[model samples]
Target: MAISAKLVKELREKTGAGMMDCKKALEACDGDIEASFDWLREKGIAKSAKKADRIAAEGLSAFAINGNVAAMVEVNSETDFVAKNAEFVALVNTVCEAVAANNPADLEAAKAIEVDGKTLETTIAEASGKIGEKLSLRRIKTFTKDDNEVFGAYSHMGGKMVSIVKLADATEEKAKDIAMHVAAINPKYISQDEIPQAEKDREDAVQTEIMANDPKLANKPEKVLEGIKRGKLNKVFSEWCLLDQEFIKTPKETVAKYLGNSKVLEIARFQVGEGIEKKEENFAEEVAAQMKQ
Candidate 1:
């Protein structure tokens, strides 16, 4: 089938791929727009892989949860302005909702999940192609399905950082509090046990170095090391442990005390843009580029 220029333009608009690429895809798929879209996605993923090493620190973290399922998705853009674009936000919502409903097992599975009568993989390809940027999905996480569990989500400053918490016997108010706390403090884990053993060992090593250099500890025997280690562990625990951190709502109370007898099993997860190096453009550069255009 012959691909028309207008058709190619439409495809280009829909998938920010180059006109030639869109045209070739349309021709390859015999003018079936949807099939052509899948072709673009397969190609986009290939392209994205090459660019994966770049640092992506800017984008939006989106969350969606239904009665029994929940998901958080991080979709990155080149600029903060683009992150706030209504089209981009809508795309994020669509992707997150698709993840919650379908509960795809991984990023690839979620991308394969269908949305708006099209697979997410193709939809993203179409968006990246249209947006004229390296738009990509950085991470996706879905909570374990439990009918009795309640999920909470908090997004700070337009999704720069986001926190998702899964809970047991959570009241609406408690859930909201947990979400708010996670957003503000950005705890590394729900508890000490959740912190990796390697990370703990590193912290211990740093603490030992500090203790050895202390003037007051010059003649202290190894027995003093235990006390110093305990102090260091307590300090680290208060900083990264969700249960140890002061409650955002009360501050006077720990998170564990906030729940009282409520069976609150908190699982907190967060993701910042993993691998897209943000392009930094200054005012002069912006104006120069505009003037040239």
Candidate 2:
């Protein structure tokens, strides 16, 4: 039984596998196009498994909104080059859409979602094989708001950063402005009230210790020191809390003042590759390895 070039071409078209891989599959399956397709898929799954341990910290953060519901997703690839691929971008969009539509409870649930009749996890595995890298759905989040609330979404640097904000009784423009501010400022909390008591206590202790260490403050009354500590704490909170920070668009007003009658209900921000430790390659070693190959 001979494998024909035509058969290899057909398999490549079907699976997007390389020409050499397609030929190998055709040969292994005795030129049966259907079997060869399956063979290629199996090979791809194997490739994906082999690359699973590789770090894939580079990719995109994308969001999809449907009516009052919005979903944001981060998809990772091994290299920035692959992150820019149209296929990779489309996959990110599809995952975002699926999460928005299905509102899966968790990351695993989102991965188990069906896309074009295939599980999203399986689809990612297949794509990893075709793209010659490990691909993963890093995170998924969804926000839902009632008719009285509005959802604002923004993506920066293509998809390097994404932010979504839910606002109650806010105009669309204001919502988008707040989302853009969140993306730019990277606020830790919506307001001072959202800060945990333990965290506040810790900051107060730190500031009080600083004041005690100061020579001039050593002679100050306890009441004066307490006021100074409060001021310092407020300054720190202004940086960490969104409502206290000056609005990006209007420097004079804080986000709290900018909102006027509206209130920020919830916010989600994703910075691509935020926590993943990327592997640094030695140029000499890389060149030597490539030369060896």
Candidate 3:
């Protein structure tokens, strides 16, 4: 069967594959457009799988702040090259802005929120079709404050990661400083209470194991062991707790004491491309495969 240009164009539009590849597939399928699409899907899926294992650490972290509410997120791509793409960066910014404006609880909800004439999910789909690469909305975290506190936000490594800090009585300068600190230090939780009880229990168990391992502990009293365990627990708590962390700006003081009168509470969250896993590409493998071709 003779292949028509229209069939090849239709297949190319649907699959984002090269024009030559589309024409070949259409010819192979005897000008059956639907079968050509299926053929392309099968080939793309296999090719995409070959690149799935590589780590995608490069992407964009965007921030959207509106009054007392702020949303910051990370959207990762397979390469630093994609991170520099203006369209990808714009998509990331739009998603972050949607997160702040809508305060969606999860990715599904955020994708459903409308932007301009289309929903976020539709926009991402459109981008994917245009860019010929996999694009994703990786993560979204929203923070809201009811008091006079200012929200601080920062993006580091050209948007690969971001951090936001919420201060109850923070001045604009202090808020910005705190945001920078969070981006640098990346504390695990806002406060000690925010740490899960399971985590605390796990730390306590590890402390008990350490105490049991000591030879001198054979003669020491149980009360002394209890005191040692408490000290270990306190150490673990302090390491993970934002307030207990040493202030990045002023290491001389703990975060709790650094901003004394402001009563700073880091209602902050840092997300780096949560849920988006990039398909990895191996240059050597790709070369080998192309050689076979």
Candidate 4:
């Protein structure tokens, strides 16, 4: 059967496949539009699977709060452009809403929750194909508190950074301020007391190694060296710990002092592209390879 230009154009419109790919699919399926569409979807899914191996270090970290229930989520895309897409942002909102409403124990449970009558798995697949990139619901954190606790959420830099804090006094204004600080400063712990023993041990070991290599410190007494180490630890906590960190807005006071009667029960922060290593693209080489194809 002879393939018509009209048939190829119709296949392209329905499948969003390239002109050549649509023509090929139409030929392979004997001009059957439905089979051609399926062919394009299968090919797209395979392409997206390959893209899945690519580092998705750029994306948005978003939050949605409903009254006393709050949820935060990070959705990853291969490029920053797709991360800002309206559909991608809507997916983030749906995931956040699912978490806030159901408080799923983990991402898998969250995936099962329906968003607009579709599961997250289907949403991710459709978005991945439609956007021509890998899409992932990377992580989620949800909190539900009693009447005494208030939830504060902040998404900074258009969700490149996100934070959620639980406050004791239910003061929404103060809680939001604290959440903003959490997003901006990137605090490691809510308070000095919350700092992990392993972290303290690591810092002490680093300081000990530094002192060992210093000739001037060799003559210091063991007690004096120990005191110095403690001092260094205190200084680090003051900078890295949330409660002890100097308030960015009011430098004269620490975040703890700024909080006054409102105490932070919990804090969570997410920064996009935190640990994923990105691939270096050589556009010239890429274009050359595509030209060959």
Candidate 5:
């Protein structure tokens, strides 16, 4: 059977494969469009797997919210340049939408959810081949709140920084401020109570050692040493706990004091390539050297 141009175009649109590849796939599948899709996917998966070992340390971190629910996603690619691609951004957005809409518990469950007849697992693998990079869905987080609660979302530097703040008895305006604060502050805990007891004990031991090392402070009364250690620990809280830090917009008041009667329910943040070891390459320098040649 002859594969028509329409079949090739349809296959190309569905798979984002090359025109020639689509035509060949269609021919190989005996003009069966569905079979051609599977054929192309099978081939793409093999090619994509070859690139899988490459490090994808850079990409976008983004979120999509629908009413009382919001979903944030981190998708990684091999290069910052690819991370900035319009198509890559769209892919991340689509992944976030799926997550928000379905509320998948994990990446495996997320991949089982279909988009336009293609499973997310297949879509990602296909995208890896399409973009010529090792792409990964690092994590997805879902935020759910009551109707009485409001949500605020902020993303900085495209998608290098993202945050979602949930507030109770607070207006949307207040949530936005808190969301921006979370991005800037990068709080480890919303309040001191949330800090683990083990972590506090660890800090206490470290602080005690510091005091012992000081000649003047070491000889001080135990009560005085305890007071100094408590003060130092409070400083840690001021630095790391969001509620204890002075609000960025209003330096005079801490974040908790600025909230007045309102309460912050939850906060979540994502930073793209936060801990990933990025390849050290100066693309500009390379380009200049090439031009000189």
Candidate 6:
């Protein structure tokens, strides 16, 4: 029997299990919602489902390297303590290894990759059930370098943040320094050339508006005003572009000067719990509510 997406969503809402798990349960039970709900319980996935609503903003950012290929992953847990758990750390390493080995294009494809005869999604669900928290694999990315290019990886604060950089015509030490710089500076683009025309135009407009409203610039010639706008735009790009930013180790020199002839091919950085909105609870209010219950 063919299972409908509506039925799968309905079952997921009722059980709180992963979408793939819910779909499998529905298929196993001939699209019967009640039966699928029971099926998930029997499989012990519903145990983790109970924690699905909890915020999982704390976890580790880790990476794995295999020869010329490397992968990075961020996995979230409900608390920092759980994020440091041996089992949780192992799971993150496993995820990173799987990503590097399979080189999946996206999160969905990465989840479908098999490990120990089980889908990555099922493995995560089982781990979540055992870990007693809402565990989620937030994102994964893979990078590859040519023989002449070198890859550098750095983990800051025991995986609270991680960065990887690929550099062409560079030594491993230089690459590692670049990666560390990337982890600290968090540049948006490798160079000014990578900035989109639209973004440059937007910044140009902003600078023009600021100068137009300035009394000091009102008497300035149009050509001078244009030069000022261009200079302002370049200053903004220098802050956002990696090569223009001052090097962390040597503030006297920009990253571009530090690199000399080497070129940064790619860079990736991940910080745990960067964008997730964490839950804040009032202890007294919670206690009162529990007492009322």
Off by over 4 Å in 4: 1-47, 284-293
Worst 10 residues of 2 by lDDT: 43-52
lDDT of 2: 0.88
**Local distance difference test scores for all models:** 0.76, 0.88, 0.74, 0.82, 0.86, 0.91
The reply for model 5, stretches above 4 Å from the true place, is: 1-43, 279-293
Error of 6 at 124 (Å): 1.2
lDDT of 5 by residue, 1-293 (tens): 88889988887767666566677778888999888877876756545656755888899999899878998889999998999899999999888898889888787788777898766766777788798898888888888999999998999999988999999999999999999999988999999999999999999999889889999885688898888999999998778899989899998999999999999988999998888877788999999999999
| TM-scores vs. true structure, each candidate | 0.76, 0.83, 0.74, 0.80, 0.82, 0.88
lDDT string for model 3 (98-217, tens) is 888888888778877889965675566556545555555667778888867788777777776687877777687877877787777777886888889998888888888888888878
For candidate 2, the per-residue lDDT at 235 reads 99
Per-residue error at 27 for model 4, in Å? 28
Candidate 3 local distance difference test against the native: 0.74
Q: Model 1: per-residue lDDT, tens digit, 99-209?
A: 988888888788778776667766765676566566777788888647777777787777777777777877766776888888888787888877888988888888888
lDDT: the better of candidates 3 and 6? 6
**Decreasing TM-score order of the candidates:** 6, 2, 5, 4, 1, 3
Q: Mind giving the per-residue lDDT tens digits that candidate 4 earns over 25-72?
A: 788899898887787677563345446567887888888887778889
The residue pairs that clash in candidate 6, if any, are none
**What pairs collide in candidate 3?**
51-280, 61-159
TM-score of 2: 0.83
Model 6 CA RMSD to the hidden true structure, in angstroms: 2.9
| 153 Cα displacement, candidate 1 (Å) | 1.7
Q: Candidate 2 lDDT, tens digit per residue, 52-170?
A: 67999999999999988899999999999999999999989988998999989999899889988767877787889899999989999999889889999999999999999999999
**How many Å off is the CA of 114 in candidate 3?**
2.2
In angstroms, the error of model 5 at 270 is 0.5
Clash list (residue pairs), candidate 2: none
